[model samples]
Target: MDIMIAAALVMRPDGRTLLVRKAGTRVFQQPGGKIDAGETAEAALCRELAEETGLRVEAGRLRGLGRFRARAANEPGRQVLADLFLLHLPDGMEIVPGAEIAEARWVDPAGAGIPLAPLTGEQILPRWVAGAFAPQQAG
Candidate 1:
C-alpha cells in the first residue's frame, strides 16, 4: 500500500489553488507527496509541502478523506492508496517550486488543468469547489 498524502491548497485573494507540475510528472498535481509510517497525516502534509513547494503549511481541518486507489500515469497496473488533507499556509507566503516540482502555479479552481493524480481531481476538486476557494478570496 503506497501511502500517498496530498493537499488541496488555496491562495489568498485570488481564489486559486496551488498545483505543481513535478519534474517527472505528466499531470499537474496538488502540492503533496508520500507519508512515512508513524507520521500523522498533518506532519506529512507540512513536510511534503515544504519539500515539494518550499512552503510551511499551517494545518487546518483534517477532512479525513478516505483512501483513493488508481493506477497513476506512469505506474501502470500499480494502485496507490492516498490520504488527502486540505491545508492552508500563512498569509503572504510566496512559493518557490522545489526540486521535485518542475513548476508551481496558482490555478483557479474553476479552471484547474488535468490533475496529475486523476483521483485528486475526482475527490479533491469538489471540496475545493464547495468551500476552499472563497476563503482565499476573502483574505
Candidate 2:
C-alpha cells in the first residue's frame, strides 16, 4: 500500500533542519502529515506544518523540493509518497509541538544521531547535505 503525505524541510539560519517525533513513534520525520482529499501539496504541507509544529506558514513560502518515495517508518509493508517542500524560517521563531507531535528538535544535516524516517534519512537529508536546496539569501 502507498500512503501519500506532504512534508516540509524547514531549515534554520544555522543550517540545522527541523524533525519531529509523533506520539508513540520512535523515528523522527519531517513535520508533516497525510494530504487530505482535494488538497494541493503546498496547501497540505502548510496545514500539516501548522498542526504539527504550531508554526504558521503561507503556502507561497514553501518551495518545491520534489517528490520522494520510501518505506514508511511507522507503517509495516507500506511505502510513503511524499511531496516535500523547503522552507527557510526566520530566526527566533518558537515551535511548540502540537497535534500528534510528541517532541521536536533541530538536527544538523551532517550528523543527525537520532533515528530518522527512511524518506528523511535516506533521500531528503542527502540533498540538503549536498547543498542541492541550499538557502538563498538576499544581498
Candidate 3:
C-alpha cells in the first residue's frame, strides 16, 4: 500500500531548502505528513507545516509542484505518493521545530551533507537542481 502525503519544497532566497528529521529517524525530508481522509492536500500541508515547524502558512501561498512517488524513507517495503508544493519563505522567518520533528536545517539541495529520504534525494533534489521549481515567466 502507498501512503498519501503532502510535502513542501520550502526554499529561501539563499538557494537553500529546509529539511526536517523526525524523531528517531536518521533520514531528513521535507516537513509534511499523511493527508487525512477528506482533507485537501493544501489544508493538510498547511496544518503539518505549522505542527512540525511552527511556521504558519496560508494554503494559497503554496505553489503546486505536482505529485511525486518514491520508496518510503522510514517504512520498508512501501511507497509514498506525495503531493508536493513549493513555499518560498519570507526573510527573517524563524523555524521552531516541534511535534514529531526532532530537528530542522537549511541545506543546499545540490549537495546536502546529511542523509536524506529517498523521495527528497532521488526525486526532489534532482528536480530542484534542474530548475523544475523555477518561477515561470508569464507572457
In the order shown, the candidates' Cα RMSDs to the true structure are 3.6, 1.8, 1.9
Please report, in order, the local distance difference test score of every candidate based on alpha carbons: 0.65, 0.89, 0.92
Quickly count the clashes in candidate 3: 0
Segments of candidate 3 deviating more than 4 angstroms: 136-139
Rate residue 11 of model 3 by lDDT.
87
The clash numbers for all candidates, in the given order, read: 2, 0, 0
Q: Candidate 3, residue 120: CA error in Å? A: 0.1
Q: What is the lDDT of residue 47 in candidate 2?
A: 88
Candidate 2 off by > 4 Å: 134-139
lDDT, residue 102, model 3: 93
lDDT of 2 by residue, 28-80 (tens): 99999898999998888888888889899998888887889999999999999
| Residues 30-54 of candidate 3: C-alpha lDDT, one tens digit per residue | 9999999999999999999999999
Between candidates 2 and 3, the lDDT winner:
3
Best by TM-score: 3
Tell me the TM-score of model 1: 0.75
